[model samples]
Target: MTSCSPTLEPPSPSRIPAHHVPIIPPPPLPPGPQDLAFSPPLGSLQAPIPPPPPLPPSPPAMGTAPPHVFGLEKSQLLKEALEKAGPVPKGREDVKRLLKLRKDRFRSDLCWILFCADLPSLIQEGPQCGLVALWMAGTLLSPPSGIPLERLVQVATERGYTAQGEMFSVADMGRLAQETLDCQTELLCGGLGGPNRDLVLQHLVTGHPLLIPYDEDFNHEPCQRKGHKAHWAVSAGVLLGVQSVPSLGYTEDPELPGLFHPVPGIPCQPPLLPEEGSPGAVYLLSKQGKSWHYQLWDYNQVRDSNLQLTDFSPSRATDGRAYVVPAGGVQAGLCGQALLLRPRVSSH
Candidate 1:
């Protein structure tokens, strides 16, 4: 089991200064294949090649990751998508390939770190939300630890969690995760009912994986008032439209990168995101575009990655089950049961 949910509270007095912050948009999708010779430390997004018409659905990935969709477009595209909206999954096979890449990884060497993020059920005895998020954060900011699971144990031990021994503590979880990512974190208690999906996309575009709290029922389980259990997963990345760099300002909105414009309807009250640090803190993927595309590290597991997720709108109540959360009523906001953990910028 992964991290379970905690009883949620109201919003904090201090909110993330999202309104003032400019949502950095991803650059135009890369035109064509970039020379493998050049590396993208914080530069361009490399996309996959298209398959010839007819035989297959998704072309095989050339390397470690799958085909690219948006290249650098993460937010501008998402915002545009919010306006027009796209198709959600209808059934099993449909959900599997809906917006996910054929493979688990992205072409960027930076994302190679994601491969080390495997939080199998065998690793820990019980639910381990903090440990799961910690491993992901560590892989995101630092080089891949040659032995990831072992590395997680080592870090937990150093944090004095080994002494605690398989105990589930939110404090320990947050602290360990904070230390691993070399960043700070804040709890987004309110507005979680509607993670906006747009805001979640914006956060992902900023390269901070959102540690979200999901009531177990959302994960295809039956629940009673007393049987409220929470689960956590990191929103790592997406599989959308991406490609090789063809030219300047060429972007798309299908997968998350598109032309930039004012994103309407961002709520400040009961705001649900963390503060954006000073300008230079978020690495810019393009200097010329309206906004920058912060790189993300996607763990790519079924639980963490949305590759096989059928938990969104339209599919909210599938298989003849009712998951309708009444707005501001008794079962509102997933019963007012969600939280957003935005990664803070590290002082060190």
Candidate 2:
């Protein structure tokens, strides 16, 4: 068998076609005298191609809806919640007007210091919902000293207001609010369920937040099933019956004007039923880690939650003075309990 060499000789010139013959080009160099002229081999160096000019930065999308907090869009939830709620009621319109006025005055008015977005979400590390709520209220109502939650816990523990993971008395909470917040506390009896519903509305409408101690479980006893404790939340404001709350957790939809989707949740209350009428939902802001949970609850939901306190027997009741009419005797423990916090110095 004949073996072929790996390196073969070039093709014979006579056998190659004339057009196929290789052409050796002259060196690429400028004309010059023989002694001074020099040129590198043709393929040695190359001129680097400059990258195409970077595309102009894209303009930000106008009217972009905020990212959704949940799978559903804000408009979908709002439509579903209000389909039967009828047209926006007059009371709701009035509330909207007042809230708008407050929004307009937010920068100039100290009374409107706490907007729905302004509520800091301080989570409870242990059975210290009350203390956390107190901290939120204290820090917001008074000048900001940047007091941490640990400090509030230490304060409450020293005062004997908290022990064994239980806030045993509502009266103690009132006193604690007065002492820690340096603000007068008015315990109100009505909570959208009783006769003082209008008053509670007034408190919230005027930008006063309520520290409500409720079952937190609503009718669902998730805590009892898990052997946990009760809860407290700050009621920031009541939502307009027909308006979209974008701040708490909504963004305007770019595709459709005046439409929104849930950024996780709405800033204010969830949508309400037609029968519930206008000014239907309340914004309940609670801590969940670093951020907060925004819930829009129907008036009855908040009412029933607050009223559940009536069944809670307080460990002690040193202060029984409630501003509104008491359904039970004044001595009744934790009945229709709510703390309306006003700044110590008038926000004139």
Candidate 3:
């Protein structure tokens, strides 16, 4: 017991004098602008701001060739073929000849034509293999001779039809011409590999049939073929004229071109014609005869003063006049025991 107590007492002296150092409170912060009494600096509490997020990645650069050139090739080919064909001829013979020539020579001539055509440099630099066959067919028949092939190609290519700035080679032209001829023969013989017969016919009938001059300097030469100019002119005129027709709810004075004149009133029921063998609103020309005649369907309704006859005939229609029958109306007889009918209005 004495030993334990003694040891405890000594411990006090050895372990005693454990001094505690007091943590002094930080000095009062100076007043900030917002704080009336004592406030820390405005931004003191916030950690240093992080740098802003990195900007978005830039867009990838575009390749040299513009995207539209692909479709333009076909159009350019068509235009070239038309130019080579010269103006459309009146009879089928010229058209057939032009078509045959194009089928024979286009490929061989394309490279030179494109060079002269003046296509864009980008296209010229790119591979022109895709357009070879089309170019050949277009150029062989329609050679652009006087014009710089490069410039024509450039213009055609601007519409995205040809390679930009590419030069033509005679070898390439020859190969292309051969290929185009083969293809044309196949097409003419109804051997084109797809359901394209109808499409080809439609194109031949409606599309531009002239060959453009490749030589920029060459004044347009009329195709040596006959009737080409007249046919081309007529077709162009018809197209231009058709655009002038008025739609429903619009009345056009035939004298005024292209402008729409509003029709204030509703359309009246159209007049009717009489029986085929009898007198009616109009008369039909016999197949054996050269001309047509008009008859009064309702002689009472239409006075003699209102009737005016014209010599015009529908160019495309067979046997010309078509008739509409009017129910619950009086029927009359035409002269010469002929069929009486109403005059047919032209759509265009």
Could you tell me every candidate's TM-score relative to the true structure? 0.35, 0.48, 0.16
Q: List model 3 lDDT by residue over 90-197, tens digit each.
A: 222222243245444222221110001111111111233223223322432344432223333333343322243221222222222233322221112111112332
Worst 10 residues of 2 by lDDT: 63-72
Worst 10 residues of 3 by lDDT: 230-239
Off by over 4 Å in 1: 1-96, 99-126, 154-169, 194-201, 217-228, 237-348
Task: Identify the runs in model 3 with alpha carbons over 4 angstroms from their true place.
Answer: 1-41, 45-47, 55-166, 169-348
* Number of backbone clashes in candidate 1: 24
Q: How many residue-pair clashes does candidate 2 contain?
A: 11
TM-score of model number 3 = 0.16
lDDT against the true structure, per candidate, is 0.32, 0.45, 0.22
Each prediction's RMSD to truth: 20.6, 30.0, 40.4
Question: Largest TM-score belongs to which candidate?
Answer: 2
Candidate 2 per-residue C-alpha lDDT over 51-126 given as tens digits, one digit per residue, 9 for 90 to 100: 4544453442432211111112323543343333322222222233444554432222111111242344443444
Error of 2 at 94 (Å): 24
**1-348 in candidate 1: lDDT tens per residue?**
112344332222233232221223222332443334434456557654444334333332332121112222344554454334222212122223321542333333221101011111111223344344444444455554312444454555554554322313334445555554444544343323234334544554544545543333442222222213433444444322222322333223333332111122432112122223211111111000111111222221222222122233343225354332323322232322222345455569
RMSD of 3: 40.4
